[model samples]
Target: SSDLSDEDKIDQKGIRNSPYFKPDWSPELLSNGNYITHFCVYKNNVIEELKGFRGDYSGSQDYDLVLRATDKERKIEHISKILYGWRQILGSAALSTSSKPYAYNVAITALEDKIKRNGYDGKVQQITDTFFYRTKYEYGNPTVSIIMPVLEDLEILKKCILSIKKNTTHKSYEIIIVDHLHKKKELESILGNNCTIIKFDEKYQNSKVYNSGARVANGEYLLFLDPNLEIITNNWIESMLEVGFISKVGAVGCLLFNNNGQIYHAGKILGLDGICSNALEGRKHDNMYFGIANAIRNCSAVSGKCIMIKKNVFDSIDGWDENLFQYFNDVDLCLRIYESGYRVAYTPYVKLQKQNQITDDFSNEIDQRKLFIKKWKHVLEKPDPYYNENLSHVNGGYFLTSSPPLPRLMTLLLEVYYERIDLQTQFPEVAEGDYSNLLKWVINEGIINDSYMVTLAPFDKDFEILLQKYSQ
Candidate 1:
């Protein structure tokens, strides 16, 4: 294929192990750089709807058009078979984004237009010195109820309350602390006049406590927050509301890092490790997992730790399923939200420090998994749409397979794990948005073993030359 083409390399932006795009993977996953390569054959009507391309964004005319077209949820397909060659001529933005510097600026304008059209009051903040962006949406100042289930560490509860009071700029919110009936005196000492303590007589049950807090919540939106989380971003609540405001998006969650600063929760995958697992768990947030950890995207499930949703929508799902007890309660809640035709969403604009010192009181983990399996076996049986079917079970579930479904030079990077220096993350900034740095991070820690990194990697004369060009 490379011999047939003017260039000897595949499109770095589309160097994915899987050839298909997630249905409706736009506004969040879609950006100016990756996956917007030229030679796209579009339906005439779709092109006509966007008026083809604008002249104002000359360097990135197609990028602007694609952003505008996909803004309204148009289904896009990624055809794997190569249909044409792309010439990487000198001075072309494709060869080096710096060659046409105005392209990145035009891309920012294009993203801004997309955000404004979506009814969200947000500005697209470009990642400095890079073509990537993160949209910050303003909170409309609607009333929100903050539900804190106090199961452990009254000390952490104090920090959480203080963080909300100190960092959160949104004043139109009420903090409802659900806890043991006997701990009222102690809770009052910490919260004082800042929060309302709802003491219950029953033992600690996350589902029950969440439902109880929802029952008494008076705000239009309900934020199910764990008492162990400390807010870092000032506009955390507002940022989440940006995604929550999207049509058909039922629940919104934010990125939560553990005390050590590693990502513990960004979003949930239904079948990542087993039934479900955290997305990009234990990995740093900078440019990770197809940039999913930091991007505003649709996910299968969002964690209950920092999730926000409309009151009526939460009630529509009848709140959490009380039978599950502890683990997977959030996953089950998200699945039901999906069954009701609403997308569970996640955003990285909000960052929270997770305090994991406290231990949970519940111990019905085995039974809960059974309940989850019995209820959603139909959904779990399928591969997680947000994750690749060709990925490995290790390295946070973001590594390539030993024998990738579709092998390429990127597979050469897969043999080695994180033990070696990671070129993928380090080299992405080499050419910014040109897909060069993007390709380097593909194999990452999984480097080649022996003569082959990917056991099934092609070894023809052309393939060897391709390997020689990228082996380092």
Candidate 2:
């Protein structure tokens, strides 16, 4: 161990030439396998199985083996320290080696056959890539107003602000704290001039409170922060802001982790088994979505903990609906934006410290039911005809509701005089696209049928006017 001779020098060629020499992942990747070293020192039953078990697959065989062993018995203690080593023995790609490819094929076939035996459908598409932030900063940093609506959790709120102040790479920003539903005394002492604290009656609704703050926000960009959330990394604001700069991006959310460091939200997965959980749950920090190092992928919707949008976008959608007090607000906003031909995306660079967690200790049935009803009314009643049951949220809820009047009018105007394609030349491209898509989606969702077509002409002028105002 004390050898300091010249012979002890690491072979630079070996280090540099090795195919597996990915500095970012090599250290942690080797550490995950270090437990093998302790096998010689301690006699363990589990070690015996691991040694005996034929993990013949390539690349991920060890990882899969470990997973299998853990699933059998979760009682094993995690060796948090680095103890094992994995050197560059071969290229990481399994198909590169004949034997390894055979092994992987066999493993995959076995897995598929097992799933078939268990009556599982193998038609699902695995999301291999995830949405991440752009490093180029193509949008350039714009002044952003970080609006936080606080109710309680003063400690976490302070931490949240501090994290933002210290970690954010984007320098031009201000924090607006909406102190409505909680005592503001604790918050008063901690806030700096960078922050503007607004007092309002305890409303308990984030939508309305956020709207109130947006009305006063002076920045070109608006970011919504929940009090319980804290920023976890540098460049978080920049990541979200870049997305906001995209003309079609309506909202952008980041990954969220709870107090325990477990992932609370990676990105929203719509149209999953009646409910959706974080994309990758309980994964160690590096083993997350982009793998051990860094990467980005797209998601359906980002978490509410940290969502950023253009100020114009916020106003264009009329901000958050005050009727939605607490829950399903984000989903509601996302749906509206999506309908308006904009995208709701999840980027990788933003890391939010999530505070709200579903816990076993407390019973929130009453509130939960209220939230469910408020959020999924379309799914429950199927009253809106534009609802496509297959389009997520409602297996049948989307088709039930009737088309709103404005959308119907626009569609009829388009159909009655197909010659008026160049009509309303004053409207912007986005405005034209928005009106067209809203009409199309409403029709596609089956909200209005042929019988409902006659009433379109009367409101065409009004619809165009509103479209200009909304999309401007």
In order of appearance, the predictions have TM-scores of 0.75, 0.50
Local distance difference test scores for all models: 0.67, 0.50
lDDT of 1 by residue, 272-343 (tens): 555577877888768754455666777788889889988888999899989975888898888888888788
Native-to-model Cα distance after best TM-score fit, residue 445 in candidate 2, in Å: 29
Error of 2 at 405 (Å): 35
Clashes of 2: 23
How good is model 1 by TM-score? 0.75
